[model samples]
Target: MLAPVTDHPDTAPLVDAVRQLRGAVAASSLPLPVEQVSAERTNRVELLNQLDDYVLPRLTSIDAPLLCVVGGSTGAGKSTLVNSLVGDVVSRSGVLRPTTRASVLIHNPDDTRWFADQRVLPGLARLTGAPTQQDDPGQLRLVASRNIPPGLALLDAPDIDSVVEANRDLARQLLAAADLWLFVTTATRYADAVPWGLLQQATERGTSVAVVLNRVPVDAMEEVRADLAGMLMQQGLGQSPVFAVLESRLSEQGLLPAAEVERMRSWLSSLAADSRARSIVIRRTLDGALDSLTGRASALAGAVTAQEMAAQALAQAAHEPYVRARGEIEEGISDGSLLRGEVLARWQEFVGTGEWFRQLDEGVSRVRDKIASVLRGRGRAAPVEDLGEALHTGVAALIASHGESAAMGAARNWRSLPGGSELLADDRSLAQVSPQFDERVQRLVREWQGDVLEMVRSEAGGRRTTARLLAFGINGIGVMLMLVVFSATGGMLAGAEIGVAGGSAIVAQRVLEAVFGDQAVRSLAAKARELLLRRVDEVLADERARYDQALGRVELDPGAAEQLDRAISQLKAVR
Candidate 1:
């Protein structure tokens, strides 16, 4: 958006990114893991959209300062400390996991430029105060305080990792919006994994940071401070200063050390929230945001790779049953039998001249001629016992030719497709499995036919094919003559003659092709694709359900991991 409109692609979506963060903050809706992933995708997409619409067009105008957002885990005194520093409860603070869902920005009136919410009217308490389509009176409470300064805004973030979950994310967005961090953690909270994780994030991107160790016990202050500071150094925040808010000092002043007490006020007042410092914070914060986005992009790349792998695994599993079924069907098609003794019975009828005994002399003569040709040539049309035997030969040949390697290769390939781990059917499914007929499914069908045709290459084999043709002629007459003689009108030619007519031999071939050719193949492919689709849906749903159960973690910012250095830096700068 910024690229085309302003002849610069870089600045286009900056405002949109801000708005997305702002919306995510306002919505306070948390998602399960899958939903979290979805939300992340949504957030990134929205940010890109914003850069085009709001940021790029205003590229010539967006000169705002950094907002140093102080966020933390729930019960980590995020709000209490904010109030203590600002000398008032600008944000509601409590012991609940989520004391604040909405983010509070504290700064002097000079710092007002950074507060861009359309809700802020002159002397307004909050955005909720602004009359608009979506308004809630109760939501408008945190007064827009003016004590911070130009180019600098102190953000009271919800929590880096809050069980309320939404607050955790509120903390994340606020972090992204900050130029620097006044990261706070008490002696007890300092050791937490969540905050450390966030601190590490700040260090990685070189965000100018300061840490405050609030409510430190008097007895263990030195030890805790040293250990915490050491950990921060290890996290590469060695230059960061740490400030200790002594618990005993708060008690002597008649206030809970963790509360908005006087000393905390004094320490916050000592920091220069003036124009120069504010400018530095603004640049640093924007750079930090860019770094964080880059990090997020890396995480998404990993997710896409995993998704692709899973999809491939599923495809292989679906193909297995399809391949096997086609192979079996081809064997059946070749022999012209489906669990029947018809093939052998028909062949015997033709070979033995079973029905020819009733034929006229001329018909019998034709039969004899054909048979003599076969016997003398040792024709390839040797009589078979049954359809079962013919089918067995082709099937055996196919399996033997492919061997175990082919079977294993198919199974291996299936592992790359989804449900690969579970494609092996149980006894019940195996029993119900049936081979489907199709001309294209398996090349074996052609092989089966070709093998049968092989014998017809020689004169002897051709003689056999001819013998079957002639024998059926004689029997066909015998049966028709009998039917005619039995007819009431003396019309022997009127009734059906033989069960297996000679002329009908060619017609049966046509019927087989119609059943097993393109029509059957198409039908089978559609069914297979449908079955696989159903299975894919089931697997994806299960994965998403598990992610839903884990939605609680979605709000954790990848940053809270560098508290010691931030604290050390703040302590050094203390008055």
Candidate 2:
């Protein structure tokens, strides 16, 4: 049994047939989720458009006749069954055994050309020799006759699970072409598992089916028949008809009895007895197919959703490191570490020898004192050293913690995702980050260094003495401006030198800043923004990588599906 699915992606537009209904299905648009709402509305339209490609083609290509395929294990009397039903030996009926090699599809002679070259279904064929009804008895030569009636073509397939692999492959191919299947088996070999597995193929694709019991002993007939029927019922194939064939001795003319042939003919008539039976078979086949397909559909959907969750989790996890790193960087910029170079540069320019001599001991002793304090404070804290190794440890920890835990984690997780995994959809795919992506992320974090250093450098641009010369800060600039205010008043104090400093002496001091009382506002604002940028960036990057990797992994390997689920769990916890 199989499912009859009429609507699916890549078919006709779902709402296209609305002209008959005097309206349409609004097939052009579907509402997208808020998260997916982009500047363009294309994906929404694509959801509907998929029907044109995935579904419509399968529907329109249904012009081929309904194939009634007869298949079974070797010596199930399938050939004899096919022969008896057709009222002719269209296929060889044999005792010398295992005769059929190529699958023979018997159809109307005119229809042979419709499918002769088909690789998938092979061909409806015609016999070359017309010698006799008994000619080439065991060769199982083809016999394409037009007597099968319209809308029906009969296929005789090779045995599944055959000793020859090619024959088994042929069986599989024939199964694909069968719109209806007649599974013939004997009472002795009824409970075999291979045929049931093969039947799953048809059941999953809406193929109509009938079961035939070709040989049954008189005493065990009822029990065997019931047992087989019970199995079918368990598999939800109860509606499929069961037909019986009794083996008989050949007549003197080596021909089957007329009554046995008539019984086989009667079965064919029942197949086409009325439209109701045809519809029943069709519906049952379609339903069975749907049942088999449901499991696969569920699995695929779970994989997709799980991938999404994993990406989100990895992103948020990455944020923690960046947040910590950003704080460290901002604090350094604010207090002094980032500005050390500029401070030294300006100190050489303005203070030169005068302030250098004064502050040299103070600064170096401050550094020495810090080291001594640490060495002395070991009972309370820990000893400190001025060596490069000592300096490197704290600095390195600040850099490594955020980059590795947040950024690298995100990259790895995303790289594991489908779109971001290996064999990416594009080079840009972020699914779990690879070694290459890790290198790229390091570059992004390093760029932040320039910003941090620049902020410190800008504040330290002029020497402290030069700043004192202008007297432009909160503590001293007012006094310098006041001196100019008094001296520049001129002539009122005759003999007083009123000469101001060079070109910059006339520059207006921060009278407004004094009034507003927020002298460090600009520097503070820049520092805050930079800090936030680092933190947010770290979080976003980690998640994006994890998401992409998980997605990519899903696409690349089925084994990654479980990993995808784990990633999804990580994603849900991210926020």
Candidate 3:
């Protein structure tokens, strides 16, 4: 065990920084680039577990004894090598398919306190009695031995390529928690894919590694050692020292001869006896782990930003269609499209087209006589109810068509994104027309017609309004306002093909202009048009809000990237 690290002013903040980064990464959610995000999240979680089980605890208690993990593939003689190094059978060694199921950590009795608590490899439950293959495989069996030096502990980990996948994963976790890896392999299996793959990872992490090439025939020792040395150098691990233990017959006690592992034993003894050497090894591995975490944390932060951007894109996709729909509705109101077809026919029927022109030619006073006579029933006109119903149907149909179109457009946009594709694949109803759409349209049209009546009644200003207003009740004036809303022109004859009934619409426009003036007529149209457009926008907004609610379900912290960046900066500064 290493001596506990002396307290420094920067230590507390550095620990907090690491903890904060771990929490941020744990809380991050990604809905896009589904496969890639899943891989990233898994890797980050593994790194975080490594920090908690090894790096942070070790860094805080730097004076604790060093832990050297004995790790290798199946049948690599790892258990035998560990037992030989300690000169006792502390770890199980056999020809079984997987000799070690649970890990065995051997420490000097004097250094028991270091491994006694839930500080190192805290995820693993501590075990005291000898572990059987049937015992829960998740525990770590601690064995105290005076033969092991005071400043070091040797952990015999499971085979990296055990037939059981859980053993392989546990082996990796144990290696990640080690201060150094004492990797053992037979001369015959040194070039096997599994152990070398692990060696490559150790190199990338800058973790200190020492290789022991065991069970080598004496004649082939020099050649195999040189070739293994070359492979290690090519893999960027030339500095990792390799020791050879020649193939030999086991003694009656089932242990290698003392001479066979003498060099490896002496090296570990020197490392443990010399505190400075132990400290150097710990510092090298610790620094490497911290540096690796800094880079990984920043990458995780970038992933968070990507998630945020994708969510925003989905929201914009649902919002943009409504914006276009609102513009179209406003354009239709201003450009006289609403006055086409049925509206024009209804207005023409409301007054006799030929009689209006004849009365107009007789002059303004005769026109007033014509209007009063028509109002008093000299002319048979369309009922106000018919015009009002037609206006309501036209406006409601416009809203319904545009509302359905917006829903489809938003669904198409969502399908174009990876995250959205998954969400919509199972629930396509989100893209369909809303079930309550017709009812909403009915309600909105009723509200708009009511608004138009209120506008006419208010614009009358209660002056000289009793007679003409009584001649045509509130519904009559409200229907007239709806017609004027459909056309910006005062019903003037711009062209024959133009939708409005130029003759009769102008007569209605003239009557209103006379009673309410040209400005008041314009104001009524403007107010009614504004109210209709406002209602349409509200309907669109409600539809768009469904997508917004989906985005809200994903938890993405806006400040996660900056928090990671700041933590990395502070970590580097302290180091």
Q: Report, for all candidates in order, the number of backbone clashes.
A: 55, 71, 8
Model 1, 238-312: lDDT tens digits are 887677777644333223445434554444444443545544444444444443443444444344333334443
Worst 10 residues of 2 by lDDT: 18-27
Residue-level lDDT tens digits of model 3 in 1-575: 22122334447766776676667666665556643798677666668777887888886888899999999988989888888888888888899778898789999999999999998988888888676766445888999999999999999999899998888888988888888999999988999998888888787776899999999999999999999999999999899889999998987657899999999889999999999999889878876677678777777777778777877888888888878877877766655666666766665555546566556656655665565567578433356777787778888877788888888888999888768877666566779767887899899999999988888888776557666666666777778778777665533335663533444455566667766788888777787888888888888788778777766766777777777777767666655
User: In terms of lDDT, which candidate is strongest?
Assistant: 3
For TM-score, candidate 1 versus 3, the one ahead is: 3
User: What 10-residue stretch in candidate 3 is worst by lDDT?
Assistant: 1-10
User: What lDDT does candidate 2 reach at residue 562?
Assistant: 49
- In candidate 2, position 43 carries an lDDT of 25
| Quality of model 1 by C-alpha lDDT | 0.44
The best candidate in terms of TM-score: 3
Structural similarity to truth (TM-score) of each candidate: 0.52, 0.49, 0.83
Candidate 1: stretches off by over 4 Å: 1-62, 107-113, 116-142, 248-273, 291-299, 320-324, 335-340, 346-365, 368-575
